[model samples]
Structure formats: structure tokens, C-alpha cells
Target chain A: MKVSRVASVFAAALAAGLIFLPLWWVFASSLRPGNSFVENLTPLSWRAFLPVGGSFANYEVLLDGDFARALLNSFLVAGVTVVLGLAVAVLAAYALAVLNFPGRGYVFVFVILVSMVPFDAIAIPLSGLFSTWRLSDSYAGLILPALANGFAIFVLRQFFLGVPQELLDAAEVDGLGRFGTLLRIVLPLSKPALIGAGLMLFLSQWQAYLWPLLIGTSPGKQLAPIALANLSNLYSVDLGQILAGSFVLSAVPMVLLLFFQRQYTESLSTSGMRG
Target chain B: MPTMSPRRWRDARLAVLLLAPAVLGMVAMRVVPAVSAFAESFNHLSLRTGVKEFVGFENYAYLLGSGEFHAVLGTTLLFNLVLNPVIVVLSTALALLLAQRLPAVGLWRSLIFVPAAVPGSVTALIWSTAMQPDGLLNALFAAIGLPKQPFLTSSGQALGSIGLMLAWGAIGYWMLFVVAGLKDIPQAVYEAALIDGAGWWRRLTAITLPLLRRPMAFVLVAGTVGSFLAFAPVQILTKGGPDGSTNLLMYDVYANAYQVGDLGVAQAEVVLLMILMAVVVAIQFRVLREERS
Candidate 1:
């Protein structure tokens, strides 16, 4: 039994190492001074995975460039998407889960089918349409399409369904309107689902590459992922700066996700049904 | 049903008001573009001349006849064929391993999950650097007295490397669902199996796995769709190749529409890709349903 315990710990450590060590290396290399990311790796020393003589030089250079603008743009886009998306999704989910209406079942089915439609496959034609409306190179173009995520709606509806019927009835008996019951009752109780769905919407827009690539082409509207990708593609590749930029881009969302780890994981568990 | 009274009318009106924004947005944004894409796929719109002509089945015929388009489909299938299974197995294994009561297991689980939280493009950039000839992976290989690999630079190994990056970014996220499923299993089932002298492998195959079918199916389907939509890493690392070897279908659609100025071909490819996805999803449902029965 003790031997088996040792083996399990060893296996867990190895798995964690495989996933976490590379990220640690990225962080360490980003801190290294003056393009030494390669030289440090040659002897496979601890220096390759540690910030021994670390400095903020790469970050200083990166922040001095246009990467800051890209980061701000990403936040702006993701922020607006989350706020507006939550409003739209919550209202629809409330109606679907609580209301007695004609064709409610059909509407729910429609939402399911639409949620299953992969956006990447349809992005080409969607971009063409957006171009015709002259929405290219704009934030509206970036935020509008993502506002009506069917999967977000689906998740919210599932959570709302789990909200007990008698609580809603009591709210109604106390003279709460439909919107009031939703805002005061359903919304308050569904915090985890809201945060989870919001995180989902936020991450979808935050890491969005193809949609932003096709729509927001101008320099002023550049996003972090696009900027990070372009940083590495330059004729003179700066490894330190690229690592620093990637570290920043990756670290921000990771912090947000970890902070809301419970909500995010639970949301994924619910959303897994849509798959 | 009875005719609408005032209260019923009010309720219906409220429902419509509540659902309007989301329903309208979904229809106008998602449903309209997708439905029109099918129609547009049958027409030719020349970007250079601004001339539009109805070209019934010509785009599909051309794409079907072309070797390059065939290669794109082949590469996409090949990538998904390897990616989905590998991710499912590895994630399940990780989940099973973590299901044990190891010390500081929660911390290790979060550490393993950190990569999934990183954005795909950022992970690709990190992996692109790490896969450089003299980078960390090769340095580790050399420590083990193995040869250095040309990961994203060589066409032969580029797709495999991208798959590795994706698996690294995704497995932890998927594993959590398996962990959740694992938690739902009754302790008595395992105890009963132990009393019957079932070994670990037997318990897993007979007890844990059959119980985990639902979550496992979810992982398989979600992993398939995620791998099918994989575009960022390919764009960041290879740009479809050292020799067009990594030119998967999604990238091909992007290139045809944006770079080559071929909207007709791009729309046709989109239609085909959707049909393929629908067919695969249907097959997965059928197989899973059969197994359940």
C-alpha cells in the first residue's frame, strides 16, 4: 500500500511537471537579460527554468511598443462582450426556463441547434457580410457577433431551470414582475452560472484570433493574441520580448480564470452537455 | 387551447420581449450568415471585377477535382483522428491518476490546469519558441542523448507538434469533467469489486469506465469539435507550412477567402466543412447511443 502511494505521487508529479514546467520556463526565459533564452537552455541548467538574474527589460521594451494598445484592445473587446452577452443571455434564458409561452420547446430546440453550429466554419461568410456593412476595423464589428452566443444562453437556461419553481412563484406572489423576479431572484441565486458563462464569453473574445483577424485589421484595433503572433513573425525575432508578451497575454486570463476557478469548472461541466 | 385572456396575453408579450434581443441577434448574426452561405456557395463573386455570376456546382466541382483541396481535407481528418483520441485518453488517465488521494493533489491539479487557462495563441507562441532547434525540448532530448527535432519548421513534424501544443492546452480542462464524473461514482461499487478480488485494471474496465460513459462521450465529442476548429496554433506557428503540409481546412478557408480573394471557393468549403461536421456528430451520437443500449 505504501509503495502504491509512492507510485501515485510520482505519477502525479510527472504529469504536473509536463504541464507546468514549460510555463515556468517561459516565465524564466522572459526574465533573462539580453537574448540569452537559447544559451541558458544549452547546458539544461536550473537557470533555464528560473529567473536567476531576471529583469523587466523585455517587459519594458514590450510595453514601450504597441503591445500595450493590443492588450487594452483585447480587454475592451472582451469586456463589452461579457457585459452585453450576459444581459442578452440572461433575459433569454429566463424566458425559456420560466415562461409559459407558445412554441417555447421549439425555440429551445432552435437555440440548441444554433449553439451546435461551429462559428469557425461560418466565419468566412460572416466576415464577408460584416465587410459589406463596413464594420471592418471597428470594435462594434468585433463585439457584435459574439454578443448572442447560443451556448451562453443554453448554459444560463440550464441553471435557471434548476432554480426551484416555488421560489419564482413566491417572488411573483409578492408582486415581482417577470424582470424583477429575474433580476432580484434568479440573477442573485445564479451567481456561479453567471460568472461561469461570463468567463466563457470573456475568454472566447479575449483569445479570439480569427474573428478579430478578419474584422479588426487596423493597427489601432489590434488585439493581444494577434500582436503576440506578429511579434514572433518579425524579420528580426526577439525571443525575450515574445516570451514576455506571451507571458503577459497568457497570465492575465489565467489569473481571472483561477480566481473564478470554481465557477469556471462548474460551467464547463454544464456546458459539456452541449457537446 | 383556450383563446388568450388578458393575463395570458400579458404573459406571452413578456416572453416575447424577454427573448427578442437574443433571438434576433442569433438569427441576424448566426442563422442568417450560415443560411446565406449555402446560397452564396453556388455563386461566383469576383473581387477584382466586382462581377457576380451564378456558377451552379462549379465551385464544388472544381474543389472536388483539385488535389490541393483534397490535401486540405486529408490533413484536417488526419489531425483530428490523432488529436481526439490522444486528448481523450491522456485527459482521462490524468483524471484517474488525480482521483487518487495523493498529497497536495489539488495544487498539482491546478498546476496541470494552468496551461488550459492560457490563450491558444499565446500557448502557440510559447511552444513555437520552445520547439526551436536548440530550445528547451531539444535541450532536454540532448540530456537524454536523443536527437534534436525540427518541430514547427519541418513539414513532416509540424502537424504533430501543433497537436502536442493543443493537447497540452486542452487536456487539463477536459480532465476536470472526468474528475467530476469520477466523483459521482459510488464508493460501494469499488468496495464490492474489491471483495470479488477484481484487480485495479478489472475494476477500471468493468466498474469505472462503464459508469463514466456519459462524461467520456461528452469529452470525445467536445474534443472532436475543438480539434476541428483548431486554427490559432497553425496560424501562429506554421502559416500552413514549410510546404503546405499543415494546411488544414479552416486555414484553407481563411486563405481562400482573405488571401487569394476567392469567396466562392471559400463559401463552398465552408458548406462542405459544416456537412462533414454534422455527419461526424451524427455518427458519434449513433455509436454512443448503441453502446448505451
Candidate 2:
């Protein structure tokens, strides 16, 4: 028993260290001396993971460009996606889970199939469709497809299914319409589920790279991932700036995680194990 | 809970009204695009003129005959074959560890789970810098007197390196599923196993693994699809390069459509990917069913 207890502590610490070391390195390298590329990042030295003569030089340079715009774009896009996605998804989920109607089974299967069709598979035609209408670079093009979220509907449906029939019936008896019960009863009762669904959609949009890579190619249209990726291609982008940008990019989700820690983690596990 | 039993006509109208927006959006975005993409696979499209000429299976045949498609498909398969197992094992191990009454369980779980929140592109860039010739990893190699490795530049190492980077980002997220699975198992089963004089290994192999099949299956299938569709890591780190060593199928399809302007070829490649994903998911379902029975 004693041996097993000691083994568990050592193993847990090692796992935690491995997961965090890269994150620490990125923050450290960003603060390293010199505004240009980091030099002498030898692993044998503590300076590799912990910089010496640390400064704000990288952020000072990076903030002067489009990085802030990109961050705000990600925040705005993801925020809108969540609000719109949740509104659409919650209604659909309430209908699917609570309402009895013809062809409901078919709709359920159809929704699942839609989720299976990988977004990347439709990249060619979807972008082509937008290009034909001259909406290829617009925010609608980015936010629209993202809002058509089936997984959010599915997660919300699962939660809605667990709501008591009595409460919904009681609301209906008290002169609540369908939407009224949804708002006054179901939505309020499913707060954790709503938060989960919202976080899932928000995180995906915030982390998006491929769609922005394709559609949002112009300078003003660049999102965070696209802009961060461009740092690598630029002729004279400082390495520390790249690290600083990555940290900033990473820090948003971390902050969100802190705010919605339980909801975020629960939703992730729910998404994977959903039947 | 019972289905809502409002006035039948009113319920029907309300249901349609509620579902319309999502249904319409999905139709325009996913369903319509997928149908058109499928149609494009059967027709020859000129990128410049935007003209379509029907040529059933010619595009698919062309893609099947090309050595590049074969190589890209094989690379994708190899990545999944290696990556899925790595994710399964690591995630299961971490899940099992986290399920136990270990020290700092909440802190450890928080640390592991945080990386999945980082954008895949950002994770790719982070690893790309660390794996560069004079970066942290190679520095470690030098510190131990080992010769330096050309991580992203070497064709042999490029694909595996990309996989490792993705796995680093993926394993923790996948762990949550298996941890959820482990949490579902009844402690009574373990107690019964202990009463039967079972050792730790026996108890685990017999009770835990047997009961945790569903979540493990979930991890397996989801992780396979994820690895199959991976794009950002390959794009950022290698750009499907170092002699096309890391050119995954999705990247190949993307290059065909966007770079070469071969929309037909990209659509046909997408069809192939769809079939592969379907078959993999089917096999997983069958395996899970067998275990359940």
C-alpha cells in the first residue's frame, strides 16, 4: 500500500509536468531578452524554459500590428456564433426531444448524418458557392456555417430529454405557450447544458484556422489563428513575437476555461461519449 | 419524460417553427454543399471557365490511378494506424490514473485538459518552434550527446513528428472520455473481484476493462476520425512537405481544390475519405456490439 501510494504521486507529478512544460516554454520564450529571434535556447540551461533578462519587447512589437484586431475578430466571431448557435440549437433540441411529430425519427437520423459529413469535405463547394455571390470574405460566410451546429443540438437534446415532463406540463397548464415553456422552464433548468453547448461552439470558432485560411485571406479579415500562422511566413517576424502571440492565443481559452471550468470539461466528455 | 402533448395541430406547428432555422441552415451549409460536392465528383469541372461536363467515375478513376493519391491515402492511413493506438493507450492510462484516488487529482486533470483548449494551429506552431533544428528538443538531444535531429525537414521523421504533436494536443482531451467511462463503472464490481483474491492486474483486466468497453470504443472511433481529418498540424508544421512526407489526404484534397483548382479531383478525394471514415466507424460499431453481447 505504501509503495503504491508513492508511485501514484510521482506518476501524477510527471504527467502534469509533461503537459505544462511546453506552455511554460512559450510564455518564457516570449519574455526572453531581444525583440528578434530567441538565441541560445539550449535545453541544458534553465534559460530554455525560463528566460533571462526578461522583458516586454515581444508584446511591445506584436501589439503594434494586426494581432489585436485578429484577437478581437476571434472573440467577436466566436461570441456571435455561441449566441446564435445556442438560440437555434435550443429550439431545435426542444422540438426534437419534447415534441411528438411525424417523421421525427427520420429527422433525428438526418441530423446525425449531417454531423458526420466533415466540414473539410465540403470546403471546395461551400467556398465556391460563397465566391459566386461575392460573400466569400464576409463575416456571414465565417459565422453562418459555424452556427449550423448539430452537436450543440444533440447535447442540448440529451439534456432536455432529462427534464421532467411534469414541469413542462405544469408550465403549459399555467398558460405558457411552447416558446414560453422553453424559455421559462426548459432553458432555465438547463443552464449547465447551455453553458456547455455554448463553450463548445465558442472554442471551435476561436481555434478555427482552416476556414479562415481559405476565406478570410485579406489583411482586415484575418482571425487569430490565421494571423498567428502568418507570423511564420513573414520575412522578419521575431521569434519572441510568435511565442507571445501563441501565448495570447492560448491564454484566451485558458481564461475561458477558468471561468467555465466545469462546464467546459463536462461538455467535452459529454460530446465524446454521447450515444 | 413523455413527449409534450399539447393540442396536436398546435404542437405540430410549433415543432416546425422551432426546427426551421436549424434545418434551413444545415440544408444550405452541410446538406446542399455535400450533395453538390458528390455531384461534382461525377462531373469534370474546368476551374477557369467554371464549366461542368458529366463524366461518371472519370474523376474518381483519375484519382485512383494517380500515385500521389495512393501515397497521400497511405500516409493518412499510417498516421491513423499509429496515432489511434497511441491515443487509446495514453488516454486510457491517464483516465485510469485520474479515476483513482491519486494526489492532486483535480489539479492534474486541469493541467492535462487545458491543452485541448489551445487552437490546433497554435499548438502546431508551438511544436514547430520547439522541434526546429536549434530549438528545445534538439537542444536536449545535444545535451545528452546525441546527434541533432532534423525533425520537420526529414521525410522519414516528418509524418511521425506531426502525429506526435497532434497526439500531444489530443491525448488529454480524449482522456476525459475514458475517465468519464471509468467513473461509470460500479465500485461493487471491483470489490467482488477483490473478494475473489484477484490481484491488481487481474482486477483491472477482468473488471475494469470489461466494463469500460463503451467509452474506450467512443475514444477509438472519435480519435480515428479526428486523426483522419487532421489538417492544421500538418499545414502549420510541415505544409505537407519535406518531399511531401506529411501530405495527408485532407491536405491533398485541399491542395487539389484550392491550389491546383481541380474541384472534381478534390470532390472525388472527399468521396474516398467519406467511404474510409464510414467503414472505420462501421467496424468500430461491430466490435463494440460484440463486446456488449
Candidate 3:
């Protein structure tokens, strides 16, 4: 028993260290000066994962460069996508789950199939079509493609199914129209699902690389990933700036995951394993 | 057929109103692009001239006959063949460990789970820097008195290194699913196994593995798809490498379309990739179903 307990503790620590170490290196490297970033890592010691002579100058340089605009674009685009995606998805999910409409089964099946079609596979032709319509290099180019998120609808519908049928019927008897019942009753009950669905939409847009790479090619239209990617392509690669940009790009999703830990886990547990 | 009542008419109208935006958006965006990709693969399109010429089987012939496409197909298959199983096994092990009554298990779980949230581009950036010759990974190797590795630089090891990077990002996320599956298993089964004097290994193989089949199947299929679609890491880290060693099919399609301006070929590659995915998913379902019965 004693031996097993010790072994389990050691395993936990090792697993945790594997993740924490790389992240700490990125965070520490982001703060350190460019030249010393490489120096600290060699002869690996605590100094490598710790801040030594760290400053905000790398961040200052990054923000002053095009990275700030890229960050803004990602935030703006992700924000719009979440609000619009959630509104669109929630309404559709409500209908699919609660209403009696002709061809409901077919519509439900269509949503599932849509969810299965990998976005990355279709991006090439989509980009060509977007550019032809003069939608490339605009916010519409970035946000429009992601607005119709079938995964969000699928998740929201699953949650809505769990709502008591009697409760919805009672609401109907109380003279609540379809929209009214959805807004007043089902919406309030489905907060966690809403947050989860919204998070899914937001993260997909925020981390989008290939679509943004294709459509948002102009300098003003560049998203965070593209901006960070461009840093290393320079003739003289700036390690500190790259690290700094990476830390910022990575931090948002991690923070969101932490903040909504319960809802996120619940969301994954319900929908993710279904595949 | 029954006559439509007033409430039935109201419900139908409401349903249409509620579903219209999402349905239209999906049809315009998801369904159209995919159908057009299949359609466009059969034609030669010039963006500048807005002229599309019908060229049946030519693009497919050009792509399939090319040595580069074959190598890309091989690399993609080899990478996923190695990557998916390694991830499933390692993550299952991690899930089993974390499921134990270890100290501060929540903290450890969160630490591991946090990386799944890191963006793919960010993962590429971090790993690209760390895998440098004088970078942090090498520094750790030096600390232990081991020889340094040319991780991303060597053609021989570059694909495996990319696999390792992807695995590192993927395992923790999949571990959550397995852990959830583990939770669904009744403790009574383990207790009964213990009463029968079954060893840990026996219990794992007999009880846990069999019961956890669904989640494992899910992890396998989803993880395989993810490996197939992996793009940002290759784009940022190698750009298909020193001699196209790291070029997977998705990036190959991107290179052909964007860098080389050959949409016809790219669409043909997309069609091939989607067909491959469909076949793989279908096989997985059949195999998993057969095992269950």
C-alpha cells in the first residue's frame, strides 16, 4: 500500500511537470531579453524556467508592432462569432428539441452531418469563393465562415433535450409562445450549456489558422496566429517576441478554460465522448 | 392525414422561424463549399479570368500519377498510423494514473488539461523554439548527460518529432474522455474482481479495458481525424521540411493551392482526403461494433 501510494504521487508529479515545464519556459522566456533567452536554457537550471533580468520590453515591442492589431482582430472576430453563433444555435436547438415540425428528423440528421464535415477540408474552395465575392481580407471573411457552427447546435440541442417535457408543456399552457418560452424558461435553465456552446464557438474562431491564413492575408486583417507565425519568418528571428506573442496567444483560451471549468468539463463529457 | 389545427400551424411557423438562420447559413457555408469542392475538382479554374474549364479526370490523373503525391500520402498514413495508437495508449495510462486517489489530483489534472486549450499555432511556436539545437529541450538533455538530438532539423526524425509534439498536445485532452469513461464503470465490478484475488493487471485487462471500449473508440476515431487535419504545426515549424519529409497531405493541398496557385489539384487532393476519412471512420465503426457484439 505504501509503495503504491508513493508511486502514484510520483506519477502525478511527472505528468504535471511535463505540461507545466514547457509553459513555464514560454512564460519565462517571454519576459527575458532576446539574447539571454537562449543562454538561460542551455546548461538547464532553475534559471531556464525562472525569470532572470526579465522585463516588459518584448511585450512593448510586440504591441508596437502589428501584433496589437492582430490581437484586436482575433478578439473582435471571436467576440462577434460567439454572440452570433450562440444566438443562431440556441434558437435552432430549441426548435429541434421542443417543437413539432415536419422533417425534424431530417433536419437533425443534417445538423449531425454538417458537424462531421471537417472545416479544414472545405477551406480551400471556400477561400476561392470568398475571394471572388470580394469578401477576403475583411472581417466578414473571418467571421462569416464560422457563424454556422453545427457542433454548438448539437451540444445545445442535447442539453435542451434534458429539460422536462412537462415543464415546457406547462409553459405553453401558461400562454407562453414558442419564442417566449425559449427566452424565459429554457434559456435560463441552459446557462451552463450556453456558456459551453459559446466557448466552443469562441475557441474555434480564436485559434483558427488555416481559414485566417487564406482569407485574412492583408496586414490589417491578420489574426493572432498569423501574426505570431510571421515573427519567425523574419530574416532575423526575434526569439523573445515570438515567445511573448505565443504566451499571449495561448493565455486567452487557458484562462477561459479555467474560468468556466465546470461548464467546459460538463460540455466535453456530454458531447465529446459521443464521437 | 389529419387536418392541421391552429396550434400545429403556429408551431410549424415558429419552427421555421427559429431554424431559418442556422439552416440557411449552414447550407450557404458548409454544404455549398463541400459540394463545390467536389464539383470544382473536375474543372480547371482561373481566378483572374473567372473562367472555369471542364477537365474530367485530368486533375485526378495528374495528382495520382505524381511521385510527390505518393510520398505525401505515405507520410500522412505513416504519421497517423503511429500517432493515433500511441496517443490512445499513453492517454489511457495517464487517465488510469490520475483516476487514482493521488495527492492533489485536481491540480495535476488541470495542469495536464490546460495544454489542450493552447492554440495549435501557439503549440507550434513553443515547440519550434524549444526543439532548436541550443534550446530548452536540448538543455534538459545536456543536464542528464545525454547526446543532443536534431529534432526538427533532420529529415529522418522530423516526422516523428512532429508526431511527438502533436501527441503532447493531444493526450491530455483525450485522457479526460477516458477518465469520464472510467467514472462510468461501476466500482462494484472492481470490488468483485478484488474478491476473486485478481491482480491489478488482470483487473485492468478484464474489467477496465473491455468496459471502456466506447470512449477508447471515440478517442481513436477523433484523434485519427485530428491527425489527418493537422496543418498549423507543419506550416509554422517545417513548411514541409528540408526535402518535403514533413509534408502531410493537408499541408500539401495548401501548398499546391496557395503557394503554387493550382486550385484544381488542391480540390482533387481534398476530395481524396475526404474519401479516405469517410472510409476510415466507416471501418472504425464496423470494427468497434463487431467487437461489442
Candidate 4:
């Protein structure tokens, strides 16, 4: 028993160390002042140990500049996408899960089929349409395309199906119309699933790099990822600022994850396993 | 069972109201783009003259003829072939490790998953920084008495480095799914195996593997689709590399359409890629269904 305990402790420690090391390095490097890429490489130095001397100059520079605009743009894009996506997903999920209609299976299958198409494959054709619609380089261009994510629809439908049938009957018997039942009963019961779907949509949109990079070319219009990429080219490749910007960009999602740790883990795991 | 008149109209209206925005959005964003891409593929388009002329199957024929296209196709296939199995195996192993009665299990799980939450661009930036000549990785290697290697600069090492980074970042997320699958397997099954004098390896093989079939199918298909469609890492880290060695088909399509103004050729590639993905997914579905039966 003692031997097993020792082995388990050792394994846990090793795993913990591996995971935390990269994060520690990112934090430490980001905190370092100045563009001393070569100087900072040494493992142990007075520079590393210097505490209060480090400044938030890099972050200040980022926030006071186009970085701020990009961050706001990302929030706008991701936020709108989530709200709009959930509205559509919730209603569609309700229809598929509860309302009997012809060609229901076909709709579900169509959603699944679209999920299989990789974004890169269709980016060109999509961009062409965006150009024609004059939605290119616009926020609407980003949010509109992503609003139709099939994964959200499918997952929400599955969760809706799991809602107990008797509750629907009870609502109906209570003189509630079909819409009323869905709005009050089905929607409330599936809050966890809806939140899960919403969170997934937000994260996916937030992390979107390719499509945004392709469509949104104007400086102020670019999202966070595009902004970060642009930062490397704006001035000299200021590794310190780049690292700082990246750290800040990464911190948003991390903070959000901490708040919804349980939902985040459960939703991601369930989605993967189910799909 | 009451008069279906009001209910049916309401239902139809609700369905139309709910699905209209998404359907129209998808039609404009997804379906339109897809159709245009197919159409573009059959034409010869260039920016100089702003003229597009139909040349049916010529783009496909051109892609077939080019050595670079063949190389890109080969690289894409190799990436999927190697990376999919590695991700599945590694993620399963990690999930299995975590599912055991390990101490600080929550911390381990959180640590692994934190990277998943990190944006892909940030992850790519972190890895790119680490893979530099005087970067953290090389620094550690030198400390451990190993020769310093140009991990990302070397043509041979660049693709593999990107692949490893992607796998490292993604494995944690995939493992979580497998962990969920593992949890759904009742503890009694493992206990029964233990009572029968089965060793750890046998318990894993006989119990955990079989019970995990459904989740495994999901992971396999998803992983395959994801690998074929991978873009961010290649774009950020290697940009298809020193000699187009790391260029995957997705990047190629992007380049064709966006960079080269060859929309038709790009569209053709997209259609081919979609067909390929559909076939692979269908095969996985077949295999999983057959296995269950």
C-alpha cells in the first residue's frame, strides 16, 4: 500500500510539473520588461529575480493602442454570435426535438453534414459571397456565417430531446400553446444545455483565426487573433509585447473557464463523447 | 388529438420563425460559398484581366499534373495518417491515467485542459516561441546534455514540430471526452475483473477498451475531420515551410483562392476535400456500426 501511494504521488507530481512549467514560463516571460530576448534566455539571473521592478508597460502599450480595439471587436463578434446562435439553436432544437414534422431526419442529417465541411475548404467560396454582398471586412460578415453552426443545433436538439415528455403534456393541459410550452418549460429545463451550447459557440468564435483573418483585413476591424498577428509586423518583432499581448488575450478565456469550470469540462467532454 | 388546425399552423410558423435566420444565414454563408467554389473550380480566373472563362475539369487536371499538388496531397495524408492515431492513443492513455485514483486529480485535469481554453493563435505563438533556437525547449535540452537542435527551422523537423505542438495542445481536450466515457462505465465491471485475478493490463484491454467503443468512434471521426482541416498551426508557425514541405491541402486551397486569385481552382480543391472527408466519415460510421453488431 505504501509503495502504491509513493508511485501515485510521484506520477501526480510529474504530471503537475509538466503542465505548469509552460504556463509559468509564459507568465514569467510576459512579466519581464524590455526587449531582451537574448538576455532573458539564461536560466538563473538577477533579472529573473527582480520583483517590483517589472512594469505593466507592455500591457499599457497594448491596451492604449489597436490591441484595445481588437479586443473589443472580438468581444463584440463573439458576444453577438453567442446570443444570436443560442436564439436560433434553442428554437430549432425545440422544433426538432418536440414538434413532429415531415423530413425532420433530413434536417438533422443536413446539419450534421455541414459540420463535416472544414472551414478552409469553403472559405474562398464564402469570401466570394461576402464580396458580392459587400459584407466583407464587416462584423456582420463574421457573425452571420458562424450563426449557422450545425454542432450547436445538433447538441441543443439532443439536450432538448432528453427533457421529460410529461412536462410538455402538463404544460399543454394547462392551456399553454406550443410556443408557450417551449418558452417556459422546455427552455428552462434545457438551461444547462443552452448555456453549454452558448459557451462552446463563444469560445469557438473567440478562437477563430482563419476566417476572420481572411475576411477582416482593415486594422481597426480585425479581431484579437488577427490583431496579435498584426502586432508582430507593426513595429519590430517586440517579443516582450507580443508575449504580453498573447498572455492578456489568453487570460480572458482562462478567467471565463474558471468561472464555469464544471460546465466547461462536462460540456466539452459530453459533446466529444456523444458526437 | 384535438383539432390539428391551430397547432399545425403554429408549429409551422414557429419552425419557420426559428429556422429562417439560421437557414438563410447558412445559405448565404455556407451553401453559397460552397456552390461558388465548385463553380470557380471549373473556370480559369485571374486578377490581371478580371476575366473568368469556363474550363471544365481543367483545374482538376492541372492539380493532377502538378508535382507540388501531389506533394501537398501526400503531406496532408501523412499528417492525418500519423497524427490521428497518435492523438487517439495518447489521449486515451492520458484519460486512463486520470481515471485512476491518482492524487490531485482535479489539478491534473485542470492543468491539462487550461491549454484547450487557450486560443489556438496564442497556443501557436507559445509553441513558436518555445521552438526557437535559443528558446525554452533547446535551453532545457542543453541543460540535459543533449545537442541543440533547430526544431522549427529545419525542413525535416518543422512539420513534426507543428504536429507535436497541435497534439499536445489538443490531446487534453480529447482526453476529457474519453474520461467522460470512462466514467460512464460502471465500477462494478472493473471490480469483477479484479476479483477474477486480472492484472491492470488485462483489465484495461478486456474492460475499458470495449466499454469505450462509442466514445472512441466519436473521437476517431472527429479527429480525422479535424486533422484534414487543420490550418491555424501551419499558417502561424511554418507558413507551409522552407520548401512547401508543410503545405497541407487546406492551406493550398486558401492560397489558391485568397493569395493567387484562382477561385475556380480553389473551389475545385474544396469540393474534392469535402468528398474525401465524407468518404472517410462514412467509413468510420460503417466500421463502428459493424463492430457494435
C-alpha DockQ of every model: 0.80, 0.72, 0.81, 0.58
Assess the local accuracy of residue B50 in candidate 4 as a C-alpha lDDT between 0 and 100: 82
Tens-digit per-residue lDDT, A147-174, candidate 3: 8998899889999999998989999899
Which candidate wins on lDDT?
3
lDDT scores for all predictions? 0.89, 0.84, 0.90, 0.79
Model 1 alpha-carbon drift over 4 Å, by segment: none
Which of the numbered candidates is closest to the native, going by highest DockQ? 3
| Interface RMSD, model 3, angstroms | 1.1
For candidate 3, the per-residue lDDT at B59 reads 98
| lDDT for each residue of candidate 2 in A1-275, tens digit (9 for 90 to 100) | 58987898778778978987888888888897444334655546776666667888888888888988888888888999999999999989999999888778888888887987777667667887778768788888788888888888888998899999999889989999788988889988999999989988888798888887888878788898998888777858877888899999899888888788887667766666774
- Per-candidate TM equals 0.97, 0.96, 0.97, 0.94
Give the least accurate 10-residue stretch of model 4 chain B, judged by summed lDDT. Answer: B1-10
* Model 3 chain B worst lDDT run, 10 consecutive residues: B1-10
Ten contiguous residues minimizing lDDT sum, candidate 2 chain B = B1-10
Question: Per-prediction TM-score, chain A only?
Answer: 0.97, 0.94, 0.96, 0.92
Candidate 4 ranges beyond 4 A from true positions: A43-53, B1-5, B285-293
lDDT, residue A182, model 4: 84
Relative to the unseen true structure, what is the C-alpha lDDT of residue B182 in candidate 1, on a scale of 0 to 100?
95
Error of 1 at B132 (Å): 0.8
lDDT of 2 by residue, B1-293 (tens): 45646576677788899999999989998988778778878988886687889999999899889998888988888889889989999999988887788767888888887788788999998988888888878877788899999888999899988988888898888898888888888888888888889999998887888888888888899888888889988777777998889999888888888788888888888878888998988998997898789
